[model samples]
Target chain A: MLYFILRRILMLVPVVIGLTVIMFAIARILPGDPVALAAGPNATPAEIEALSHEFGLDQPIWTQYFHYVGGLLHGDLGTSLLTRRPVAADIAAYLPATLELVCAAMLIAVAIGIPLGLATAVWRNRWPDYLSQVVAIGAISMPRFFLGLLLQLCFAMWLMWLPLGGRLPIIVIPPPTVTGFLTIDTLLAGDLHAFTMALRHLAMPAIAMSLSPLATIMRMMRASTIEVMGQDYVMTARALGLPRGKIILKYVARNAVSATLTVIGLYFGWLLGGTVLVETVFDWPGLGLYATKAIVSQDMMPVIGVALVIGLLFVLANLVIDLLYGVINPKVRYS
Target chain B: MTGPLLSIRDLHLTMTSFDGAAHVLNGIDLTVQRGEIWGLVGESGCGKSLTGLSISRLVPTPPATYRKGEIRFEGRDILKLPLREMQDLRGKRIGMIFQDPTTNLNPAYRVGEQLIDVALAAASHDPSVLGCPPGAGRRERRRAARRLAGEMLERVGIPDAGARLDNYPHEFSGGMRQRVLIAMALIGRPDLLIADEPTTALDVSVQAQILKLLKGTVADHDIGVILITHNLGVVAETCSHVAVMYAGNIVESGPVSNVIESPAHPYTRALMAAIPTKASKRGTLKGLGGTVPNLITPPPGCRFAPRCPLAIPACTAALPGAVDLGADHRAACIRLEALEHV
Candidate 1:
């Protein structure tokens, strides 16, 4: 098993490097003049040169890549054009809110999606199966923007049972040091006022972002469970006279988890992309919003920084998934 | 002593498809007396597996629907029983040993837990996850299940049954798993044990061990056993009674010696001749000539008529009913009477 896992870990190097190259190319090609945007349209010629020198944008592409990487090692992300603060600190403040929201949404997605998928697979022709299938299909096909609006209106406007957007109320003082995001810090301090407000604010957007991925997870899980149910081991379970439920839980679930892990990991990485639209719609302050602003304003350093961070996250997520194969599937061994 | 444990009369099944319906089993008749080992022999896609599945109520329908049949187990008509009753009967009275040891047990569970569960399920009417049924209660049931599982495992030649109970399916060897399956089957102490091609997926050497284990286990329980396989040698060694199925129909059935030495039906003879034996080195193995006929459009009279070398026009006139030649021997072929007097 150790041998197999070692092989998997070694295999990730080429994959991460390839992804890094692609992200680099994408950052360069996206329409933006970081120097001009940072200095502003009305800045004098010398001011723009000074800003370009400060960002090291005046260097050749390869030099810039190395210089940025050097800056990355020191935890410097240049200055945010909008906030005039270091991009790393800005991202540190913003990354966690998006992280919390995505995590919450993914939790809900997995909880609802996996069971629905299993239900559909087991009761292949029953009403529950058909209903789940229909709902998942609609969720998958519906545009995320429209669904976000619908969720917001129902949960935020009419029911008013939950807060629709924002991290928390202004009266709620964030911790002395905002390490990741204010919500987590507030919750850590056991500040109920702030924690409840943050949670309520996160609900609609989290639920909204979860819909499409939930459908995706459901489809994958359903197919995997159906495929596994026919395996010889399951038949063995049947011939052994195990109860129908135990057979499903023990035999079917174990075999299904390995396949499910890869899908979940891929979706987790993809969630970062979906977060942009979700965060905008809900007015949630997170990396997605920062990314969008940075991209639109041609703020090269921040845009590149976000891409690198997102790319790194994607790599790390996939690596975790690859490692998980060892745990879920006995056949997968890391040396 | 007198009556058979399981008797099937006029067992017919048809499989429906988008194009048409295919007749699978046709007026089949079989009986397994107590403590006897009966082997049903057939090639792949023959109704051999479907027959076994029917006994276990595992056969899929929508495609398959029984036309008419009376599957009498003990004295009750199992086919007529309610589904819940049938479920009750399954692990208790009609334990099945499936083909492919690797696939026969749930891979995720420890061998011990599954074995114990089957044992408990078979020994009692009520079901419980960890304990004995309500009347039996939880603690007693778990103990009984664990004890029986240990005993049965030991009987089937597994070493250290107590220690190995926690080990999952993948931990055991293929041969060991089959032994585990046999233990599961006989743990219920059912009147009849149905082992469907138990050694089909095993190594030739492992096949012998499994067959020996099964035969010994059946004898110990004095349970009538129905062993389904394509291997004539397996039947010759393990079965007292042999039934040769062609397509879905049983063409010949009698004492194993009679069926193997002088098969009455053409298809049965073809099947025996097809087996490669040590005695017949060169072309002793004469493979069946024609492909199986499409079951959807099985010939009017006999499904095997198209494949039989001795087939004539009269053979296809109608499906052959069982031709009893006396002394508990029967063959279903249009030419059986003309071809033999024994």
Candidate 2:
């Protein structure tokens, strides 16, 4: 097990390096100069040249890449042209909100998806199963941005409930920002009022973000559960006279979960990649919103920085899934 | 013979698929006595396994419809019982083992956990296992169940049984996994055991050892066994009574010696002849040359008529009824007189 862990950790080196190279190349190849964009459209040519020189954009692309890699090795993500702040610090500020939203969305997805999936398999071809299939397909096909807008319209505008967008009401001071996540910071500060307010603000955006992942998980789990029900071990469990609930929970789900795990992990990575439109629609402050702003303003530093972090996160998520496999199935550990 | 432990009368099972309904088991009648090992012998797709499944109510239902049957266990009509009651009876009163030891045990779980699950299930139905002082915690009950599981594994000849508690099913060899399954089935101390081709997935040498283990288990516990297999040799060695099935119908049945030594039905005779002996050279060995009839549209008469060497014009006229052949033996055939002459 230790050897497996060590090998996986070692594999991350090349993956990160490859990601850095791609990010560097893409930044260099994109149209419009970052320094020129930073100088603004009304700026004189001399001012643009001075700004370009200041940012070392006058150097060759290879030299700039080396500088980026060297700075990365030293734990520096450069400065965001938009905010005039350290790129890493800006990410640290914005990332937790995205993480909080994604985590809450995942929690909602798992809570509803697994039971619905199991029910569909248990009552296959029945009304409940058909209803779930229709709901899941609709959820999967419906655009998250559209869903977010509809939810805002119904729950916020028409019903006059729920804050339309954003992490917190402007009037309430967000608890100290200790954890950067409003939900956690408020809880840590023991402010029940702030926590409730944060959760209320989180509802629409999180639900919008969760629909696609929930549908994917349900569809994957339903197919796998149906298949696992026919396995020889399920029959053995039944023959053992295990009650229906125990049989489904212990034997059937235990075996079936592994088949859908890869998809779940991939969806988790998708959530982490940031649901750009969902974030845009809700205006919840996060990396997706941050990356979009950086891209539009032609701020290459934050764009590259966000891409690298998400890439690293994807690799780590896969590693975590591998570990999860060992926990769920002992056969994987020895083999 | 002692009172029958299990009896199935006029049990019929049909599987309906998109193509058509296949009459899989056409009025299967079988009786197993206490402490007797009854081998339900047949070729592949002969419905032997289905008969065993029906006894425990384990047959998957939608496609497999029980048309008409009465499976009586301890004088209770098992088919009429509610699903909840049937669940209590399964593994506690009637244990079952299936073919393919490779897949029969769940790979995700440790072999010991699976065994302990069976023990727990048994304990729930029969509170005698809760011998703990009143109000024993779950941990204590689990510990007791684990100890029983270890003992059961040892009884089935699994080496290092205690140390191997954490081992997954894949860690064990095919034969060892079979033994684990046997331990699981027997841990419940069921009154009847149904082993469906339990040794088919094992090595040639492992087959004999498993058979011996099953025989010893049945003899020691006084458990009636319905050993389903196509191997006549296994039946001769371990089973006391034998029922020969051909295409979902029991063509002949009797005490092992009577059935094996003098098979009355043409299909049984052909099955016996098909088994090669040292005296019979490989090239000269005879085989019943026709395939099993498709159950969807089976021939009008006896299922084996197409393959029976002794088949007559009247054989195809109708399905023959079981004809008594003295000494508790019976053969389903119209050519009984001809068999006597032979």
Candidate 3:
């Protein structure tokens, strides 16, 4: 197991290098000049030249790439032209909020999706199955941004049940930054009111982001469970007269969940970086929002940084999934 | 406790699909006693496996409906038992092994964990077996069950049983895995074991070993077994009694020797002739002509009439009753006396 993990981590070296290349290329290829964008239209050519020289933008593309790689080795992500702060530092500030939001969304997706999937499979062709199919299809078909808007209208505007958007209300003082996750920070500080507010603020955006992954998980789980249920082991379990619940939970679900877990892992990594629309709709201060602002202002460094981080996150999520497979299925040997 | 281990009387099962209701089991009767192994021999789609599933009430409903039957396990009508009561009887009082060892043991779990689960279940029904105290904690009971599981694996001839417990089902070879399944079924020490083609997926050499293991284990446990198989040779070697089924009906059933040596029913005789023996020359093996009749609209009388060369008009008029031939042998054929001329 240790060897497997080590090998997986070692394999990431090439992937990370490839990601850096792609991130660097994407930023360089986009039409527009970071120096020119930083210097307003009123600035003279001389001023633009000085700005370009100051940021090393005047160097050859290859030279700039080597310099970027050297700086990346030292954890220096360059400066965001718009924020006038280190790109890494800006990412550090925005990343935690995105992590919290994505984690919450995943929690919702798994907690609801798995049971719903199991229910649909066990009671296949019944009303529960039909209803779940409808729900899953509807959830998958609806666009995330559109779902976010609808949720905001129904729950935030019309019903006044949840907060409209953002990470917290302006009135409540923010919790101390312990884990950089507001809910966790608030709970650590023993501030119930702040934690409750944090959850309320989190509910809508997370739901919007979760719907598609939830549907994907539900469908995958349902299909996997149906297939596993037909297995001879499950029949043996039934013939042995293992209780219905035990048979479903241990024999059926344990085998069925492996495929769903893989889907969940892929979705988890995607959600971390792909929540641009949900974050935009909710006005949440996360990496997606930061990336969006950076793109609009043509701030290339942060864009590159965000892409690199998202790529790294995807790799890490898959590693975690591979490790989890060894735990869930004994047949999966590390060797 | 005084009655036979299991008895099925007039069992009629019909499976309703979009096409129509197919009469899967037509008025079947079977009796199994302690320490006796009964082989139910038939071709595919002949309802032998379904009969085994019906005994355990494992057949899925909606698609399968019991038209009429009484499955009495230990003098109690299991078909009439409440769902909860039926569950209690399963695994604890009645155990089962299935075909395709590759698919029968769950791939995700260790072989020992699966065995321990059955052990725990059996222990729950009767605490004295595992020697759990009156108020044993969960951990204590688990330890006991684990020990029992290892012991059971050793009993089934798995070498290094203690170490092998951690191995997953995929790690074991086909025959070894079948032995593991047999261990699991017998760990519960159920009175009846339903083995549905347990050795079908194994190699020819391994098939004999698995059958021997099954026979030996059931003998030691003193449990009745319903061995469902398509191979007549396996039945003759391993079973004390045999039932020949064709198109959802048992055509002939009696002492294995009596049935094998002198088959009264024409279908059974035809089946025996189909088997290639040392005396039978190449290309001389007689194959039973015609396909198994479709159960949806089965013929009015004897199901094998269409395929029976000796079939007469009287055979199609009504289903034949079982005619006793001595030595506890019975065959459902009106032309039993006419077989002497052939």
Q: Which candidate is the best by lDDT?
A: 3
Model 1 C-alpha lDDT per residue in residues A1-335, reported as the tens digit of each score = 56654665666556545655565677578776766777777999899898778766677777876665677668786677666788898888778878888788888999988887777888888888888888988998988778888988898899888877787767777664555555677767878787778778877888888888899888888899999998876765565456788778767876776788888888888887668888999888988999999878777566766766776677677878888776666544455
Q: Tell me which of candidates 1 and 2 scores higher on DockQ.
A: 2
* Docking level of model 2: medium
If ranked by DockQ, best first, what sequence of candidates would result? 2, 3, 1
TM-score of model number 2, chain B: 0.96
Q: What is the TM-score of chain A in candidate 3?
A: 0.97
Tens digit of per-residue lDDT, candidate 2, span A1-335: 77887887788788778877887788877887777777788999999898787777788988988898889888889888768799999988888988888888988898888878888999999999899889999999998899999999999999978989999889888798777778889999999998999999999999998998899888888999999999898898899887788889888887778877787778778888866888899998899999999999889889888887887777777878878877887777734
Q: Which ten residues in a row have the lowest lDDT in candidate 2 chain A?
A: A326-335
Sorted into a CAPRI-style docking class, model 3 comes out as: medium
lDDT of 3 by residue, A252-331 (tens): 99889987899999999989888899999999999999999999988888888898888888888999998888788877
TM-score of chain A of each: 0.89, 0.96, 0.97
Fnat, model by model in order, equals 0.45, 0.80, 0.86
The lowest-lDDT stretch of 10 consecutive residues in candidate 2 chain B is B127-136
The C-alpha local distance difference test score for the whole of candidate 2 amounts to 0.88
RMSD of 2: 1.9
**Model 1, span B129-225: residue lDDT tens:** 3345467766787787897788778888999988888877788899898898888877776678888889988899999999888888677778888
